[model samples]
Target: MRPTKGKLLGILAATFVGQMALQVGVIQDYWKKNYWSGQGFAESLSPDQTLLQLFGFREFLAGILWVRADSFFDEGNYDAVLPIIRLCTILDPKQIDIYATGMWHIAYNFTDEEQRSDRRYIPSALALGKEGSRQNPNTYELFFETGWIWYHKIDDDYHQSIKWFRQAQERVDMLPARRNLLANAYQRNNQVKEGLEHYWKLYAETAEQYEKQKDIYQLFQQKETLEQNLDTMIVRMVQRGWLAQERGEAGQRVYDTTEPFDVGFSARVIVDEPKVLRVQGTWNVLPVGTRIRIIVRDADNPNFTLAAMDWDGQNEVVLDPERDATFMQDQGFVKNRRFNKRIDMSKDPTMYPFARKSENYLVEFYYNPRSASLHVQDKFGWNGEGMTDKNFLRTDVRKEFEWIPGPKAGMFTEDWKLAERPTPPARIVYTALTLSRDQILRKGDWIDKTPMVQTSNFDASRFSVTTEDIIDVPTLRSSAPSPIAPGEVKKTGDNP
Candidate 1:
């Protein structure tokens, strides 16, 4: 059928226009998704701008903001940089550097600035690191950086640091530096078992690496240092009574207190024919005129004083010829007591009744100057007959000590026994001996001017050492076999 030309032309033009409009919409959507989603584009356009104007430039915008943030950081305008950095992170959430650098600036640089009084800075920095990790869950750097902030910058909380460090460690990309930091954190936190585990792991790995390299000399040095550290840690644990022991052995424990004074006390219960308790340790460094009072009392009844002693530093006489003669003359024959003493319970009859009681006891060492004054006057023949001003300066110390015995089980009256002590791991002792052997061989050559012996053929490698060949005694091992790898020799040497 014949149609009008005007109607046909109108139809064609309308169809072409609609097709163009559809193409324009597709282009706009692509631009928004690929380009305009980031912070730079958002900043470039006005807040009231239409959605079309805000589309398709986010990555470019994020890059621009990152540059500006870096400049702000260099200018010491940390506060100004934070928002920009945060915006950059939001725009490009996968950028690991943004999170690490931003958090570092906030936590370290900002807090270390001259006007560092803003208490909110640290927590805010921590929050930012957390958010960054949340945004990129697979990244280990963010977690490690966050842990570093907690360990070094904020509260020196090893627990929090170790937690995050461990999280980072779970990732395969974790750095060796992070592992070392974790080991240190364990040691500093007094988690000795964990520390030893890490140390031994590191030692084993280092030995394996060094053995392959045939860098035996450096390996010897490294092993020696590690063994020394292990020995020192063991001694410290034993002194602190952290190590387990049998019932008949001495029960030792160390206490750190901050009530009457900042001091540490090591108490040991000697399980002899007549069990005796000994308490002793160094106290806080005090001023010259400071006085300390040591008191033992029944835990259940504080009124019952078991033993008492007064230490007056003012009464101390310096015998050094270099001191002022006049000052020496003024201070009488009473030696200056530094508040370090080993008090024996068996020798003190007054302490026997309290010790025999099933209830626990308390030991207090405090700064009581007035009490010291009274003791000084009586002992030094002053009699306090004419002295009008009896008031003496008193400084309150901030440490208190208390000890309690184990309680009987409820409903069944049986004496509570100490928990079994953990036996030191066999690998630890084996490693120590191996290290000691290397050290001795190295020193023996140096001293006797002999060629270094082939360590592989040494008798110590077979763990066959006579008493005469023993160096320092290796720590006791558990009943379990040593974890030393097969073909790895346990060696010992003469003490050097």
Candidate 2:
């Protein structure tokens, strides 16, 4: 059959347009690899997905996978979502939410029988965030997430968190609230001098924002918080410096080894109703905002926590949703050196099945100085340097603390003399208490009406002085403005 010339021309035009679109997609992908996402397609994508990506279908495919991941999450299929999350991020690397939410799932979703997070996955979560930051160098949210994980989840590694928060603040689009976290990390890391300086800057910035937008309540609130934090830090700095100077003049180190604050950790359990109990405790710290982490779970159940971060899409996803049948957890904050919390495991049978009534339960109480507030850290150091617990005091070697420069004289006159001696070593000192099922449930022969008290008596012999006990404080800025008022202050160690 003879075809018309016009029909043949139309066919040629359609073919040309299709070829141009394909070429444009390829060019766009090339630009994305070199400049946008900072990775090649072959490194992260499967061969089939690579082909799809070349056709500009990466975002679409990533969206579809994200939807599937959400579905899996809703169905309690947490393990299945990891590979999907990985692929989605690789496919559309610019999507920040995937990195944030995916890291959260990996770090927190994998739980044990007692609902304790499988902490082994934390490093993998950190790796994911680091990779995300590499891909999105201009964005601050991923950097902040990385800092948050270190600050909260990675055992309160404030020194590590400071690194990421510093980077996050470098970005121009950083949020004002997130900017304050940098100060918090500094404070927690025992770099109170740096923290105060940062707080002053943030306070001034927020004050400007308040002047510009008087109608916005958040700006005013932020300004107030910064002001309060600055004031508190100043007071603590003055108090600590005075104490240090007094000790030094008495031929002692900056921190006295002879006198240690006794943390009399005690607990009481009162049964309010079936499966409901009031847990109260007192610790001998005169600071507010300290908290104790509490965990109540079946004692006999073995920890069946999986530690793999299988984002390669080749590994099988296996999880047992029934592991958390009897798990309960809470944190009680201290007010006036006392903490009380009520736990009601009566609701949501699916979440708290309490299926193993015959088996004993374990109630765990723990307090870490690294996770405590700055005021607490000021008195106790970052590692319980001035604290003693007779019953639950435990010590272990940790490698997190690093040496920081001693404070030089600046706004305050006392810091220079106090900084002459070394700071306390960030020794891993902690207090912990565990209650058996009989003790908490009032079952078997352990029934008692009196509150259970675990007093830590001081033993002077235990704290013998040693030359190797010297520790380092946080890095102090060479010069800082006075927190009381805005004025140029002399640099530390300057000639008067």
Candidate 3:
């Protein structure tokens, strides 16, 4: 049957619309499988936004949303940024900056009134980063970002971090600075040999690049850092038996980790003035990089303490901004076997309001072997296995991340309890003390004579630190010998 002109035109228009819809569906399905599979299309965007995306304005929409998110961030409207970041990622998953920036904001920017990061957001940040990596698999930035989340934000999960960092390092686009993270992850995971190899390769590459282009001062600077790190690693490795027989090189001293190393770790805090503290301690470790983390906060405030990673993202935990807001934390480097730091909370009234007068204050000192220098870890094995303290010795069993190396370095067993298990990582040794409000805020200056083990006298003046000291690596040797003599055992004196 022959149709009229209007009817024929309408029929053609309908057929065209249907064909277009089918093509759009096919394209979207392809995109969903290959990229932006993080969220369902309808779930992530409104009708108008979806229509805009249909017109190939996905990146445009993403940029606009990211700008809006940045505005929200600048305004301190952090809650509003989360949904925007989610939308932006779904809109344009390939925007590496959005993923990196959004992940950082989610992981670190969401803090409480006390400035402690809301750990609940960490899972979201990690999820977002992983999704971005899935979308942009060829890029190195998102991989690096995800690695950093695990490396730093997720409580020394070097095993987990190394996977992402290694992936990032393999990519040709990875920045030179980002490459160090992979090396660091290797060392932190107790893969000292692998870490040293990576450092040397990276340094050689940087030197070659600098030789090619002498105008790039940053490369030279990078080479210097690489050299320093190399020196430290070499020294630590030699001292700890990791580099025992490097062909033709013998007579190297390797310390025995089976024997306990008495760090003689003791810490005391004295209030020098209103809202000011003098924290002094002796770790008796000769490593220059060992640091004591000191935290001063309201006794009732638990947020000041480092919390384990919350992998359970089923219910997002929100932080209360109003309650327990005052907190101060500083890390003091152990120099000459001693750590001393003057913490003045008098400044930044907004940060350290000291609002709770009636409540007691807690002063904590932490020496996590995970965070200490490799040289320090030579005496105190990872998880403080070989460390002993007379007074403030603590023991706690923590989950160990076991990873199979080679091509499957990142893969882990579904069940952490493997049939043939290695020694369960144990004992996170640290130190702490508490004080009444009167003692912290009102008491005058006084020295705290706490019963702490004092190591045998080692002349610290003979050993001095210098930039050139790195050149004299072999000369350093075990000159700053063990805190306790080989025959002497530290007295744990009957202090219950």
Candidate 4:
């Protein structure tokens, strides 16, 4: 019963198709069942890691290599997964979903749980994304992933944006959303020609969003520079205690949680003129409670104050409204978890005490708290280097008093837990200046517009800077404080 010519041809064609379909289905099923056994990935691990011991080598040998890469990557076997992923991609470059998902899992995982966390996966994801985009050139998702990896995971090179733009521009009908995304990448990387071209195309071609021309127009508006500077200044102020925000006004604050604590906020009393207060026989002229505004022209801001007292570490121990805790009224002082505002001094035993001269001290201030949001901690004894109170410090954060009483003279403080920590003196005393006008500028104006600094007949080394004398550096846009003459030091008796 031989079939006719047409029937025979059709029968043969059907048989061939059926056999090929069955073989492909069987191969896919086998791959699905054995691929992610976790052991095969162990074998493919690089020599550096020991994942094989954790996942098994028997299962690894029989598994599809691609699945091994994904599991190893998830397990933080960065070095191990790279080779496997590479091999898998080489074998099946056309597997679009695998290329996207597997590479992403390995490349973008950012964890440092044991210092063994694989933060280096971003590059692997980027490499796979790029390969996928090349293989599936018409696929918008591949190019989108590539652009994302390049824009975020890798160095955001402006030129790299062009590649993604080209991929999205393929003649194989692209989705409007993906089309717009390509335009955005172009703008981000500053691809002027392609960026503007697509932007306008988006405006004219479809009903997606045409008024977006304003976005393109505004993007070029020096707003980026302005925004960038705004970011930097916010960070700078936050570090200086002036600004308090998490992200520094958007992007300027590049937070490194691992960064060691620096003395961003401190009150440095510079002994510019050590001899000025004890001026030749003018002892009674300035009374005990005189408040003098302070300055450190060489330093950054108002966090530091210069107060003069007898050269003894035993200045009045006042209530530390910022740190000291109070259990009762006169019996117990309330401990302030945080105090941004400067408090006035009173007759409290913890009030201003005479800080010893001839020997200097630097007072370190920190902000992070164990429980509270606002805290002022001392950061001096943190590194375990030079400690004022060795036992009072935690391994991480500690505060210390830093100042050179002399060339090599350092003050040592005992970790005394008095009932109440002494509060700052009620008066502002100008013991000395940090930098003189001559030191800042021989001729031009300073960053501060206040009183120009000058050496005084107090004939002392450091000058007593009247609030007016402290001026800004002309270079930076700051107001100059009105000048106070050398002879007319503001008296506490005078209305401030």
**Best prediction by lDDT:** 3
CA RMSD per model (angstroms): 27.5, 15.1, 9.9, 25.7
For 370-451, candidate 4 gives per-residue lDDT tens digits of: 1111111111111111112211223232122211123432112112221211321111111333433322222234333332
The model with the greatest TM-score is: 3
Give each model's whole-structure lDDT.
0.42, 0.61, 0.64, 0.35
lDDT of 3 by residue, 7-89 (tens): 99999999999998987978777876655434345554568755655546777988888899889889999889877876777
Single out the weakest 10-residue window by summed lDDT for candidate 2.
304-313
Q: How accurate is candidate 4 locally (lDDT)?
A: 0.35
Candidate 2 residue lDDT tens string, 236-311: 6554553354346523544432345666666655555445666666665544567777656666555411111122
lDDT of 4 at 334: 13
Ranking by lDDT: 3, 2, 1, 4
Question: On TM-score, who's better, 2 or 4?
Answer: 2
**Model 2, backbone clash pairs (residues 3+ apart or across chains), number:** 1
* Per-residue lDDT of model 1, residues 300-391, tens digit only: 44222222211111121111111110000001111111222333333323213333232334444333221224223221111111111112
Q: How many backbone clashes does candidate 4 have?
A: 61
Q: Which candidate would rank higher by lDDT, 1 or 4?
A: 1
Error of 1 at 237 (Å): 3.0
